[model samples]
Target: MSHSYHVYILASKRNGTLYIGVTNNLAARIFAHRNLRGSAFTKKYRVTRLVHIEPFNDVRDAIAREKALKKWNRG
Candidate 1:
């Protein structure tokens, strides 16, 4: 069976501190973030809400999208 890749954005609250990342398992990844185990930035900022998510059939596409989103100015 094939796996799914996801590009997701986590936030402390609406329009609050944001964390963007990619994961193969959305639920598990979000769970980790909620438990303060996802990443140092997310944990420190308390970015626990799964505000946005995008699925991709190719991991490369997910990664590229992730990079693009990360480069975007939060303005």
Candidate 2:
């Protein structure tokens, strides 16, 4: 069986702070964020809302998308 890779976005609130990440286990990753165990940035800003998710067949694609999203300016 093949696995899925995902690019996800988490936010503090609508139009608030945002975080971009890539993971093979979307559910577990989101769960970690919700419980303040995702990362220092997420914990510091309370970015717990799962705002966006994109799945890819390859890990490289997901990682590339994640990098692109992170480069997108809020402006």
Candidate 3:
């Protein structure tokens, strides 16, 4: 089975940091983040925790959402 989702970024606290991503498996992805294996950015800034997530039905949609988030100012 193929699954897709538009993963989102979340700060450790209010405006503590920013993380942008997309994943087919939210649970696994979040677990990775919590363990410090999520990604280089998250690892660098220590942005671990499931603060935000949005599921999607299409990979394209997820990609688009990720791109949009990427363009946003982390401030």
Candidate number achieving the greatest TM-score relative to the actual structure? 2
lDDT of 1 at 14: 82
Model 2 C-alpha lDDT per residue in residues 1-75, reported as the tens digit of each score: 455988999999989999999999999999999999999999999999998988899999888888988889889
Local accuracy by lDDT, each model: 0.92, 0.93, 0.79
Backbone Cα, N, C clashes tallied per candidate = 0, 0, 0
- TM-score ranking from best to worst? 2, 1, 3
Model 1 CA deviation exceeding 4 Å by range: 1-3
lDDT of 3 at 41: 79
> What TM-score, computed on C-alpha atoms, does each candidate reach?
0.91, 0.93, 0.81
Give candidate 3's TM-score.
0.81
Q: In model 2, how large is the Cα lDDT of residue 61?
A: 85
Error of 2 at 72 (Å): 0.8
List the RMSD of every prediction in angstroms.
Answer: 1.7, 1.5, 2.5
Can you give the lDDT of residue 58 in candidate 1?
Answer: 92
lDDT of 3 at 9: 76
The candidate, 1 or 3, that scores higher on TM-score is 1
